[model samples]
Target: MSDTTSPARLVVLISGNGTNLQALLDACQDVSLAAQVVAVVSNRRDAYGLVRAQQAGVPTAYHPLKPYTDSGRTREDYDEDLAAIVSGFQPDLIVCAGWMQVLTPVFISRFADRLINLHPALPGLFPGTHAIERAFTAFQQGEIESSGAMVHFVVPAVDAGPVLDQIVVPILPHDQLDDFEERMHVHERILLVRAVQKWLTERASLPAV
Candidate 1:
């Protein structure tokens, strides 16, 4: 845990291009933000997010799932090791930017209140993968009027966590799938930064440990 006097340490997890991670990294450059990204971890070694973290001079780690599975290790055991690696950073907060894996309950419980995720859809709308595409399909069928992005606390259940902040992105009639997805990414980045800053502000009000 970090006190108000010290900068909060962050560990970010990503599975793809880490645009949201980049946003947080940029935000940390402002000394007033009171947070620092200590490390970036990816389940995929090839994730571009690692490169971004490296370029930013932040530490990077990779913990692939297949190797563990191949060795007859249970998901729980793998997560335990993963938690240990993340805990080594002593993160005050952990953000899942584009991490595609559904975290096991053991890992979620270990981090508890410190874990969060940025999902590219409105809460309770599109919970799983292909969220943007699903939302676009719903729009094409006139099944929905709008789609959005959210930053929420991470729980054992996938995408069922309480939302911290969200931005409602309207679905325009002329919006194509690619265009709409690009717009949603913009909203995601903004909302993610907002939620993190909000957490920092709230945490700042707490008494020192």
Candidate 2:
């Protein structure tokens, strides 16, 4: 845990455009958040999140899993190496903003209570990739009326971890996929920041070990 009087250190992981990563970067600028994104790591070298981190003057790392797969190494091996990279930052928290990979227990146990993720669906629904498209399709099929986004603890079970915060996003009758996606993203940014603030407040309230 970080000292209550100091800004909490954060390490963010991303795999793509990193709009959520940008949100965290922006939030950290506000003193009330009491956190600093010390590092950003991406599984793909081309992930624009790394560029965002660089623009913010935060350190960046690219830890791709291709070499591991090419060498016939296990997922655990890749996770172990990824954990090592993250450990170097000594983050008080690790946020998987847009990280696409399903982390193994090796990495999960290493960070354990400190790791969290932002998923583009309500808890227990559309648990994996393509959540937005899946939800929109479900709505079109008359199977569901709305979907949501959440920030949650990153357990080994995909996005099934305990949710910290969530918000329902209604699927309007005439909405297009892109329109719904954009609206959900706006809500997601707000929810992610709120969840981090809530987590930090709770952690600060705990009695010191």
Worst 10 residues of 1 by lDDT: 26-35
lDDT of residue 76 for candidate 1? 93
For each of the candidates, the C-alpha root-mean-square deviation to the true structure, in angstroms, is: 1.1, 0.9
Supply candidate 1's per-residue lDDT for 92.
97
Model 1 steric clash pairs: none
My TM-score estimates for the predictions, one after another, are: 0.97, 0.98
What C-alpha lDDT, on a 0 to 100 scale, does residue 144 get in candidate 2? Answer: 96
Candidates' C-alpha lDDT: 0.91, 0.93
Quote model 2's TM-score: 0.98
Residue pairs with clashing backbones, model 2:
none
Q: Model 1: residues >4 Å from true position, as ranges?
A: none
